[model samples]
Target: MDGRLIYLMGPSGSGKDSLIQAAREPLQALGCEVVRRVITRSAESVGEDAEGVSPAEFELRREEGGFSLSWRANGLAYGIPVEIDQWLRKGRHVLVNGSRGHLPVALERYPELVPVLLTVKDEVLRERLLRRGRESPEEIEARIRRNGLFVGDGSIGDRLIHRLDNSDDLAVTVNNLLSLLKLSVKPDQI
Candidate 1:
């Protein structure tokens, strides 16, 4: 049996990095491999645990087909190394921080992937973005707007896209994700 790809996506400030960090141990215990993305940003950046590389290096790697999945968002490039294919072939469940706009392509490549949408209340999202201090007020507002549009756009449809609400506590969201994972994958695999 091939492994399932859990593609977790959400707007900025939806606490993806925090959730992944907190759930890492539990996810590993359940045989899920949380992939570390390759991003075109500085390692010193205070964000997700991505491997940062220069733009030139990123382009070189992409051109050389080192990445199985790649996309550009928020003015930066992100890549998922081709090693994920090997992990999946070995029946090891994999989780990736993915882009909503790139979901169609992902589904095209991995038809059986489990698409997960992490969502937060607009007020909560706005507050978190402000606390992170990574974007200007205008930029934050724009993100919130985009998030609203995405949520209400009917794009997810009934395509087996699971939704996790990260509105109140991180622990709750983590538990919910674990439960969803258990339900999504085969029992023996877990």
Candidate 2:
């Protein structure tokens, strides 16, 4: 069975992490795996299961071909370990939290990529970002502005882009994702 690669992309504070966390166990039961990433930021700074490395080290690994896919965003570098290829070869349906800017390169690298764009309303986004308390108000505003570019541009045309609105109940969003992945979960199960 050839595997499918689900590439997840969303603006800051769009609840991508929350949806992934909630869907992981049920996805696993359906023989799907959510891949972790390697980042140049400190593990303490990000709330994800990421392998942290220095900028120099990240460059070294990138040069050594240790990553199947890599890109820099918002002053930080991210890499998907090459082990994911092995998993795909084994017919494992793999999902990855990825950057929107890197989707073109990833699609070129993995022809089977299925891109999903998780979106939230402007008010909801502003509220969520403020609640995060990770970035300065200025930074949050910048992020909100950046998000406009992705959402406004109709550039994702003709590609298999799955868009989900996460402004309301999280369970509804998760259910939509499960349905998109063809994995069904009972209401009480998730």
Candidate 3:
């Protein structure tokens, strides 16, 4: 199969959803497919293109081998549907908004997978998280703390990772992402 999997991972409030949306057209022009994840969190709770399922339901799905890959974080379970395997095997470039903690498993499963790690300044992260209003102040602080070690916990290294800073304008970040994927920017899209 000629398809490649791009695993996009980042901290909370790092503009992941926005980046994914913005990159869709350009990436697709280059024959890439971006997929929404199956998150345990309700769709109404966030802007991500995700389907929400109860924890129990998620567990059932996991046990029944419904997910090609799955991971849990911050008390929420996340999964990539098994349908993606077919897409990849069919030589469709597939991108998934993924979890950093599950990178090892993902890498093991797809050796050709590229891990795109998104990051932003600490202050910017704090400000964005606060603006998002999805968590309490204490919860935000806890999230920030967790994000601190996201880059250097030692599970993965920088060698194979393509890191991007999302602190500035999103257009700039999206352009960088396109370039990273070696996708030509369509003039009309610029």
User: TM per model?
Assistant: 0.95, 0.90, 0.89
Residue 92 displacement (Å), model 2: 0.4
Error of 1 at 97 (Å): 0.4
lDDT of 2: 0.84
lDDT by residue for model 2 (1-190), tens: 2677889999989998889999898888766788888899898777777788999999999999999999999889999988888878787778899999999898888876778899888889989999979989899889888878776543465675778899999999988988887732223322
Ranking by TM-score: 1, 2, 3
Q: Which residue pairs clash within candidate 1? A: none
Which residue runs does candidate 2 get wrong by more than 4 Å? 152-157, 183-190
Stretches of candidate 3 off by over 4 Å are: 153-159, 183-190
Give the whole-model CA lDDT for all candidates, comma-separated.
0.91, 0.84, 0.84
lDDT of 2 at 12: 81
- lDDT measured at residue 18 in model 3 versus the true structure, 0 to 100: 94
Q: Please, what are the lDDT tens digits per residue for candidate 3 over residues 31-69?
A: 788887888879878588888988888899999998999
> Among these predicted structures, which one has the highest TM-score?
1
The residue-level lDDT of candidate 1 at 51 comes to: 95
- Worst ten in a row by lDDT for model 3: 181-190
